[model samples]
Target: MIGPATPEGTLFEGRVHHMSIERLLAFSGGPFTLNHWPARNLHIDPEKAAEAGFPAPVASGLQAQGHIIRLLIDLLGDAWSRTGSFHSRFRRPVFAGDSIQAKARLAARRAEAGVTQYTFDVWCERHDGEIAVVGTAACTVHEPNPGVQAA
Candidate 1:
C-alpha cells in the first residue's frame, strides 16, 4: 500500500504510475451512449468507426480521464478524493483495442492555509507512444496531527 505523501516538494517528482488496461466494449445503456444511436461509433461496430475515419471504435475521452484519476488515487489515496482537482484535454483518439497507461510528474508545490498542496503534470499514453490525454492535477495532502497531550 502507498504511504502518505511527504512534504510539498519532496514527493512524486518524475514519478510514473501505470493504469490497468480496460477493453472498450459496447454497453447497451452506458454513459454518453444512452439514447444516442450515433454514439455506437464508440464500441459496437468497427465498420462504422472506419467510416468515421477512425481505425477502430474509439473509446470515450472520459475513459482516459478515469485512468489518470485512478493513478492519482493510487498514489494519494483518500487525500486525492477529498481535495484533488484536474483538467484534461483529449489529444488523440483512443481505439477500442488500444492499450493505455497514465503517467505523471510533480510540477510544483506550495503551503497554503496549513495544507501542503501539490501540482502534477499528468497524461495518458497509448502503447504506441501516442498521447491520448494531457492534464494537470492539484491536491492537498494534509499532515498528520501530532498526538501531544497537555503536560
Candidate 2:
C-alpha cells in the first residue's frame, strides 16, 4: 500500500518472497554453490532439509530479514531505510523452497519535532501457517531526499 489513506493507524501487508536456492544465492551477491551456504558449513543434512520441504540448504535468518527490510524500504521510501532498525524473533526455521510473506500493521503514529513517527507490528509467515519471525519496528519519516523525489 502507499501512504496512509486512513488517519494514523494505517496497515499494510506485503506479498510473499518465494524462497529458492537460486534466489538465496542471488541475495548472497553471486551464484553460490551449496558448499558455500551457511547450512552446509553447519553440517546440515540434505535429507533432513528435504524432509523439512527444502530442496537444498536454507538461507540464513539474517538473509530473510534483509529481504523483508528491502521490501519495506521499497514501500516506505528512504525514510524507513535510513533510520529504521528491525529486530525479530525467529519462531520457526524457514526452509528453502518455502514461500513466505512479510506483513506489517501500523500500531501507532505520532508527530514529534515535525517528524512523523510510525510504529508497526511486522512479521513473516511461512506458507505452512508457521510464523517464522515477528517483531515491532518504528520509523521516522523525514523530508524527501534531495537526489530523488517521489513521483
Candidate 3:
C-alpha cells in the first residue's frame, strides 16, 4: 500500500512489469501467425512485422499506458484510483522484447476541499534509453479512513 502523500519535488520510479511475447500475443487475442493472418502486428512473427516496417512485433500503446498508470498507482495507491487522471502520448513503439521503466517527479501539490491534489510529470523509458511515452498525471490525496484498520 502507498504511504503518506509524497512531498513536492520527490522522484518516484519503477521497473517494467514484464510483458513477454506470449503475454503480448495473449493480450492481442490468442495465437496466430502473420501467414495465418490474425490482426496486424498482433503476432510475434518478425517477417510480418518487417513487412509492416517494424523490426519486430510491437506492444500495444495501451499496454504502455497501463504500465504508466500502474506506476502511478504504486506510488499513490487509492489516491490514484479514486481521483487520478492521466494524459499520455506515445512517442515511440515499444517492441515485445524491450524492458520499460516508469518515472515521475512530483511537480506540485495543493490542498482544497479536504483533499491534497498532486501533479506529476511522468514518462516511461525503454531499456535502450528512449522515452517511449510521456504524460502528466494528477491525483488527489484524501484523508485515511479511520474506521478501516490496516492489515
Candidate 4:
C-alpha cells in the first residue's frame, strides 16, 4: 500500500509554469488544435485567432487538468501511485499562448482502521490572472502499519 500524501493541512502552493507553443505541442503529442477540442478543430490561424480577440487558439480544458495533476504527482510522489482521485470543473478558457499555475490547500484528514484520508482544495489559474478551474480532491494514504495501530 502507498503512504500518506502528507500529515494533512499541509498546504501545497505552486506558481504557474508557462507552456510555450513548442512545449504545449510536445506535451500534447500532436499537432496544434484551433477548435474547442474533444470534437472539432476550427483550424484558426494565429492572425485570425488574434483578430478574433483571443491571443491564440484556446487550449483544451483537459490540458490544464493534466498539468495540475503532473504538479501534484511530482510533489506527492508515490503517495498518489494508487490512492487518489481528482475532480475538477473548467471555469474559463485558457488560450495556448497564455501561462498558467496551480495551487492546492490541504483541507482535512481522517484516519480509519489503517488508512488515512485527505481532502484538498485545488485550483488552476491563467497567467493573466483568470481562474480557469476549481475543484476538490480526495486521497487515501497507506496505513502507518498494516499490522500496527497508533498507540
Clashing pairs in 3: none
- lDDT by residue (tens digit), candidate 2, 1-151: 4343335555565677888766664654333555654443211446655776766666667766765676567556777757787779878777668888877777776665556676778788789988888888877775332322321
TM-score of 2: 0.72
lDDT over C-alpha atoms for residue 146 of model 2: 32
Mind giving the per-residue lDDT tens digits that candidate 1 earns over 1-151?
Answer: 2223343333332223332223454332256545664344535467877888877677778877787887777666678877899999999977766778787777776666666677888888887999999989988776542321111
State in Å the error of residue 19, model 3: 3.9
- Model 2, 85: alpha-carbon shift in Å? 1.3
Q: Residues 19-59, candidate 4: write the lDDT tens digits.
A: 56555555543444736432323122456457667667666
Q: State which candidate, 1 or 4, has the greater TM-score.
A: 1
Which portions of model 2 miss their true places by more than 4 Å? 1-9, 28-39, 42-56, 143-151
Worst 10 residues of 4 by lDDT: 36-45
Backbone steric clashes in candidate 4, count: 1
User: Where does candidate 4 clash, by residue pair?
Assistant: 16-101
Instruction: Assess the local accuracy of residue 134 in candidate 2 as a C-alpha lDDT between 0 and 100.
Output: 86
Better of 1 and 2 by lDDT: 1
Clashes in each model (backbone N, CA, C under 3 Å)?
A: 0, 0, 0, 1
Give the least accurate 10-residue stretch of model 2, judged by summed lDDT.
142-151
